[model samples]
Target: MAEFEAERRMPAEAEQVFAIVGDLDRLSEWMPTPIGVRQTGDGEVHADVDSRDVHADGLVGVRPEQLRLEWGSEDSPDYAGWLQVEHAEPGHSSVVMHLSFLGDQPEARRHGSAAGEVRQWLDDALAQLERVVAGTS
Candidate 1:
């Protein structure tokens, strides 16, 4: 499997940062990926890649005790990831996001210009998270 991870230190406590991460409805506000995530009345979560592409049904697991959130595609199990929040210091915390590509073409997508794009996307996501944590976004 091919994997990518990004960590960022936030100016708030672990619980504070995790409160934002744990919200399922506000995902697109901070996360650059997975636009238009919505949960149906029957409790099934769905997300669209774009307005024109196919929608993916998914599962989301939230663990408040561990300050972690796990999500993956149920329709296409080739990718899965989790977000973790840890206490860094007094009144400060660090958040880590990880993505794993379990498809056959993982290695190819992890190299060359594709790798750079992925890295930038991860960083950009964290930057947005930072803004949200700081109450600026």
Candidate 2:
């Protein structure tokens, strides 16, 4: 299993952050990835690559009180993670994204490997997300 976590301070309320990440469909917007997303009832969303990447369909677990998005995928059989937002203070929030992918496909190995690209992608995504959310408010 490979796990990665990145944290940042966002200039927005935890609620705003939660709402943004909750819309799993906008994933590709902030994260430089080509994700095709479709709503799968409730708040869950099925995301894929080229529509053929069907294994990673799942939901963004949103905990309003905790200000987080515990994300997981149905792909590759064993993948789970989360994005957390903490109320750092009255007008600021701390964000943390933790992801774990279980496999041994070199490209899916530990960080600094092929999987590093995805890790970095998420890092950039979170940064962009912070900017986007701050902009709206």
Candidate 3:
């Protein structure tokens, strides 16, 4: 399996970041490319590539100090990962996103490049989120 992980410190509270990531509809706002995601069930989400629907399974784990999401898409050979938030203080938190994909196909390799691009996108999005939440933007 190929893996990619990134972490960032956010000024917002953990709950705030957790809420943003948990809301499937908000993915297009932070993801590198515009993605259409809809809740398929209580904890499952379906993503659309442009307009073609892609299936994915998700699980949410909530704790007193953290929130985590484990997800995997059907199109990927073995793509699976988790996004997590750990509260460090009342107004500060850490966000970690981990993604893994398995395969060696040309298309799979191309899609793998998304790991880096997506990480940068999340960094930008988190910055914007911090500004918006702080009402400085």
Candidate 4:
């Protein structure tokens, strides 16, 4: 399995950050991949994923108390991830996103270049999240 993590500091409180990050339905606002999400059940959703004309079933667990969100693809066990919001310096919050690519994928995707791409994706997603938190996006 390959794991990657990205973090950013937001100009907001932890609760304020979590309010945006913890919303499963609004994933498209910051996720950079999924275009839309519909809740299928408690902690479960169907997402219009990426450019693929495919709707993927996903599990999303939101913990307001901990300011954390966990998600994974139910259709493909190869993908799983979590997002966490924590208190930083006063008037600031730290957000971290972690992704685990499990099992087999194409050769190119398992290489160093793919790792860079994944990191870029994560960075872009976090930048979008910052915009969301700031009410700019």
Candidate 5:
């Protein structure tokens, strides 16, 4: 398995940040990709993502301060990932995201490209969130 992680500090309060990440349906508004998410059951979601080069069915898992997903295209092995929120201070929060693809996919693990992609995705997503929260977007 491979791993990618990124962190962003938001001016918004922890509760507010948590509220945003907790609702799966709001992902399209702040996530980097134009993705639509739907909850299928407990700890499960389906993502209709349009921005990435590949398309896949995503399974979601959620906790009070964390969200996770497992995804794979029809012909490829699955990838798994999670987003976590941590309260850093009053009216401040941090987001951490981690992603990993199956071990056998050489392309997925080579040159840390997968990790870089995920980091960039999270960076953009958080910037958007900051804009929205700060009433600048």
Candidate 6:
């Protein structure tokens, strides 16, 4: 799998950041596109996501203790990722996003050949997340 990690520091409390990121339905507010999330089970287990322009029918795992969310392609498990928030500096928190995708896919195929795009998208998503957190702060 081709993978990359991106980090962003936000001026918000760790628990607050976790609240925002931990809510699966709020992903679209920061992500590039709307994420349609449905509870697949317990808050600590899985959630189903339908990001029409991105991953469709993806399964996400939530680890609240670590403030992390993990996801993988439901169809083939070819795409996967991790999103986390950690306490940082004094009052601020840091967010880290790790994403991986199976290589050698056609451009026509979304996840196969878009590593760079995915990285950039995550960067933007983090920035937007900061703004959202700041507004609520």
> Residue 7 of model 5: what lDDT?
79
Q: What does candidate 4's lDDT look like per residue over 11-113, in tens digits? A: 8999988888777667778876535677788889887845446578999999999999999888998888899999999888999999888867531254676
Each model's lDDT: 0.78, 0.70, 0.62, 0.81, 0.63, 0.71
Candidate 6: tens digits of C-alpha lDDT, residues 1-137: 56777899988888899898888767666775433345445442233334324444566777889888888766656767899899988889999998776754432234543545666667878888988999998
TM-score for predicted model 6 compared with the true structure: 0.77
What's the CA error at residue 37 for candidate 5, in Å? 4.7
Q: CA RMSD for every model? A: 2.9, 2.8, 4.1, 2.7, 3.9, 4.1
Candidate 4: where are CA atoms >4 Å away?
Answer: 33-38, 51-55, 107-113
- lDDT for 3 in candidate 2 is 74
> Stretches of candidate 6 above 4 Å error?
33-55, 106-113
lDDT by residue (1-137, candidate 2, tens digit) is 67777888888777777777767666655664555556676767777654224445686666777766676765555677788877778777888888777766443567564577667766887788888888877
Which stretches of candidate 5 lie above 4 Å from their native place? 34-44, 48-53, 65-77, 104-107, 110-116
- Which 10 residues in a row give candidate 4 its minimum summed lDDT? 105-114
Off by over 4 Å in 2: 24-28, 50-55, 111-113
Off by over 4 Å in 1: 33-36, 40-44, 51-54, 105-108
Which of 2 and 5 is the better model by lDDT? 2
Better of 3 and 5 by TM-score: 5
Query: What TM-score does each of the candidates earn?
Result: 0.83, 0.78, 0.66, 0.83, 0.71, 0.77
Model 2 TM-score, 2 decimals:
0.78
Error of 5 at 126 (Å): 2.0
Candidate 2 — worst ten consecutive residues by lDDT sum? 48-57
What pairs collide in candidate 1? none
Candidate 3 lDDT, tens digit per residue, 99-125?
A: 665765322343445555555655665
Task: Report the number of the highest-lDDT candidate.
Answer: 4
Scanning candidate 3 in windows of ten residues, the lowest lDDT window is 105-114
> What is candidate 2's local distance difference test score?
0.70
